[model samples]
Target: MGVCPECRAATYQMRQGKLREEDCLRCGWLAIVGADGTCRCCRAAVRLGEDPAWLRAVLERRLLPAGRPLQLALRMDGLRLKTLPLRQTRPLTTVKLPSWARGRPAELQDDPCVCVTEVPGQLGLFAPCPRSFTREHGTRIRGRTPVEWPIVLAELKAIAAERGVGETWLVHTGDGARLALASRPPTERLVSPEALVDLPQMRPTVQLVLQRAGLLARPRPRLVPGWWSKGRGSCRDCLAWTNGNDQRCRDCQMWGHTHADGPCHRCGRGLPLRDGHCRRCLLLLAETEYDLDHIALEGGDQLWFGGPYAPHLKTTTNRAGEQTGLYGRRRLQTKRRIAVQTSRATAHTVSEHLAIPGQLLLFHALRDWSRLDGRPLPALTPNAEALLADFTSHIRARGWTLPGNQASLSALKFLVAHLGADAPFHETDVRLLAHHPNFAAPRVINYLRAIGLLVPDEKSDALLATARRYADEAPAAFQDGVHRWIDVMCNAGTRPSLPLAPSTVHGYVRRARTCLNIWHTVGIDDLRAITADHITTVLDTLTGETRKTTATAVRSLFRALKREKLIFRDPTRGITLTVAIPLPKALPDERLVGALDLLPFARDKLSLTLAAVHALGVHDQRGLLLDDLDRARGRLTVRRAGRLDRTIYLDELTHQLIKKWLAERHRRWPSSTNPHLLVTARTSADDNHPKVHPRAISKPLSRIGLQPGRLRMDRILDEATHTEDPVHLIRLFGLSPITAMRYVRAAHPDRYRPLPIAP
Candidate 1:
């Protein structure tokens, strides 16, 4: 329960209006029941004079509001106002049942209920009176009832129309019970939601709303015309009017035109442009299009595809310019003309003949057969055709007169064979031989042979013999002839051969004059002129020294003659000749002893007498007496010292005697400190003392005197003459017969008269 706003103190119940005992609790106000069954304080109305609004207000405040009364006039004219019961009317029998009772039961109950019924009149109003009184009074009473709300019913019909429903049913409040009424009945004249919503009275449909939000269905595709078909046009290939091209259509016309542009579409090409028509479609229509046949023919189709080589079936014309019936026959004639012209051109203009078979094979291997038409021909083997073009160019450039055909080809073949794959014609050799004087057959042979080309033996033998005959000539002249010979050999192609050795040729020339000279001097001709014996005799006569000249002069003359080619000597002859001549002998001078006596020596008797006065002057002080001197003399005998004989003579004796004298003198004077002589005897711990030996005196004496046997020879020779006793000199000097004679001659050249020779 809650208090109403009109009567704040009044506690109201929900869904209940007329009350018999309760007063307005708010402001101590009184509850006035108006005829219209509304709350006066709250100005809230209710159904059947029941104040549900007031009750709702009072109950919502603690829960709502209390009832209020309507104005007098409003209450009087309430028939125009609409109303509904606040609560459903319970059955009379159910009113007496307990609160837990569900449906209507068979048990009967009799109870007097105080029910408030609404009254209706001209000034319709709701009055809360007992049902018993209303029945008892029966004074023409009008009970409260529900009025039909035409506005609400019309709104229901509008909702049905918006929802696309056919008919709509609604419940309305009546005085006694609820009644059902059709807001609108289903009928054949019903409109769809789309149509109804589109009407001004209805809202938009779902599809139209979606369309406004940019979610509509995709539009259907449309057809458009092509560029050529959009206007009048003709097919470029077949020249057919595209607009009226039978049943072909524009696309088919395009395809047909494309097909018509092929090689077969021309008039003579044999392929029909139309199904049964010979002329193009454009021509039949008398329309302006390119004259395709005339254009193709004028553009050199005959050159490119007609005649024998054309891929299509032949078309022909006769010599008089009329079309021929047998096309193959005309084509054959044309082919024959072409072949004749080609052959003439090739033969006259081209120096080199391209071997078609070889070229085709090469093209097949390289897989570039189409290139054969324009590519230069490959030079297959050693052949003349390969060289002609180059050779012609060479001869023309040099302003040389070329040889005849046979000679030129022969030379070219020789060159080709000689040069091989790396032929000089292919490179520098071309330039070398291009302007050569002998560019003909014979010269070519020479060139081939000069470079050691293989050739036949017959030609080689002839050339070889000729070359040998002239081999001894000067190099320049010889080489010219050899080159000519080589040329001949080359022309002969291995028929002739030649031997060429630079050294041998040079040697032969050098020997030529010498051989001629030898021949002339010996007065020999034929085989004898070249014989070794005669040559040797000539060398001896030419090289031997003559009595009229010195040996040196003779030797010089032989060398000069040999160098000048005046004579020839064979190194193979190792013979030599011995020549003898008288030479003046040198005689010794007898005054040599007097010259020896002038030298310094010791003055002892043995040194003066036995050693000779000359020997005395030559011997040093210690050399006068030294025993080792004798030992050295014996050791210096002929065998050990390379003398002529082993016998000891005056020179040997003098040296030994001096040695003995020096040794004895050195022993007597052990302390003598002289280097020239060893004398006296003293022991001391000093290194300056002289250790003179035999050689000390002998070496100095030999240097002072030019003795034949070192120093002793002069000593002996001098001593023997000083005594003037040959027997004494011989006995003391120990001279042999020959040696004695030599000494006698030296000491006394005039005195030593050789005994008359016993003849």
Candidate 2:
């Protein structure tokens, strides 16, 4: 038996000689089966070691009291016994003892008396009397109030027996009332037979009960050994073994302690080394080299690094390895160096060469020179640069008006091609050629002519020549031509001689004629006579009324010619009638009347007014007068017995006779609406009717006579013709100016005679 370390008491052992018996002989610890087959000490019971059979028998008992106060005690020989009330707050009732303890003898007298001490206030102690605690008594105790003492003791003993602690032990309180003590330590209680049989079986039942009550324990994390530590390994940095340790290794002191060799050149801290250089130092070196190269390559300078004569050098002296061949590498390196040097040199060259100051060469190259040369080249000399600058300035200042002089235009073309290949030559070049101070206008004109840039027509030749003669002494001929051409084309759209209406075509013909006349007078044979054919052809080709309406148009031409003093009638070939017609009376009857009304002319002042009224025949009396003259002529012919009668109507006929003559004559003149009469010869084919042309109506009146100027001629012919009634004369002879003037002179000879009466 093992001794209890805390109590210094010898432990009880199971007695093999007795069935289910355990006793402590030295300490006088004794327990007998009062209700269970186990020894008890100090009012508690303890089991000897039990097999499945005994444990099963022990559990089958109803151990806890039903309604009364009851107490249970468990004790071991060497350890302190534990005493607990089966019913903490209620009274205990008698319970049936297990069958395993029914035939067992009690040994309470031989065992040491365990002192019974009362706990203060509520907790009480009870003792069992073997006689009072019979089965019948147990049943009766269930109904008793405040519990029967013997039954209570028996219930407590039953609880102790069920828990496998003997009921022989007594329960008592410590002297200070702070604790309660049992005379003996507790015996080992039996675990469930179910638990001992299968832990898996018991676990699920236990877990289910606990879960239902919400008291289930959390599942512990599954740990895989060697995969991750479960409170068992050192920190990662430490190289030490940590089978079950939490701290890091002493050597490293940190979580990670992987070693690296190189330190940073700039920061002086150990850093990861790669490709023979620390990361920081490598970056620093690369940046430093880049900055150095950038600075050295900038501006107009060349620089080298990591070589002899360089300010900074990098070398590996200890390792006597073969040196890289400098030939090929140097060629590549030298090529780059040469490129940099060439670029810098080109920049400097351009700065020195170009005339314009403060202009960067590289920018000029990109903006201007590259486009000029297809790529940048060595710069121009200062002279060439000045020429270029001056040329460009001239071009910008003059614009398209720059001269096309051989030297100047050639230089401009070259410069423009160099600077702006796509720019067009402007009209300013022609203007400049015409007006430039250094060049003669003729020479410039000649050059423009040679290039087909200027063509001198009749209109432009005079101005052009004038420009040339004046040459360097005058303003630009080309500019003058531009203005003049604009005016001519813009304004010259009409002329009278043109085939179009006089109003529509007059201006054009006039301008052409003017230009032609000017050219001819100026001794320009090529321009002379150009517009003559154009005018004549235009008139000849006219196809409408101007061509077909000969009578009306001849009348207009007669008036036009008379007004212009271009009319000449000899009367040797044909009778002549000379008149000075005003512009209002110059048109044909229709137009003349329109002009008369439009002009508001008085009747007396109108020269062709009577002719208009007579031709239009608005009055009946004119037709009656002509009819009477015809009838009187017929009467005289009959009176003379078929001889032609030379005398016709009376010189001064009555109004009715004149009215009847006009009415008769009005039937002959198809258009006769005025009171007028005239004879026209009839054709054989038209024996019944007279065929008289309006123009021929006045022909016989002019020739109405015998004896070289007979009665008809003598009656109507006079130099200064006058009449008492000019209106009557207007009705007679169709009242045409030519016919009326002849009659008026014949009738009033004295008034018309030579105007010599003043002598």
Instruction: Please name the candidate that would achieve the greatest TM-score relative to the true structure.
Output: 1
Question: lDDT of all predictions, in order shown?
Answer: 0.36, 0.32
Residue lDDT tens for model 1, 723-750: 6556665554445566665665667667
TM-score to true structure, per model: 0.14, 0.13
Write the residue-wise lDDT of candidate 2 on 1-759 in tens digits.
321121212222122111222332112223321223223332233232223333343355333321221124443567755422222222232444443333223421221222233343433233211111112211222222221234334444454456565423312100101011111112212122222112212234333333333333355364454434456653332123443354543333321233355664544555444344543234334334434345433333332221122221122223566422212233334555666667665574432222233333353121222233333334445544554465445434432244443455443333333333222222333344334343333323333343433435234434434423332332232233222322333343232331223332233322333333344454445311233333343345444544333222223323333333333531112312233332111222332333323422221112122223222221221222333345444421112223332232333223243444345444443442222243332221121233335334333223321111122233233312444665565444334565565455545656766546322
Candidate 1 local Cα displacement, residue 363, angstroms: 84
Candidate 2: which stretches are off by over 4 Å?
1-378, 382-534, 537-759
Lowest-sum lDDT 10-residue window in model 2: 172-181
lDDT of model 2, residue 71: 29
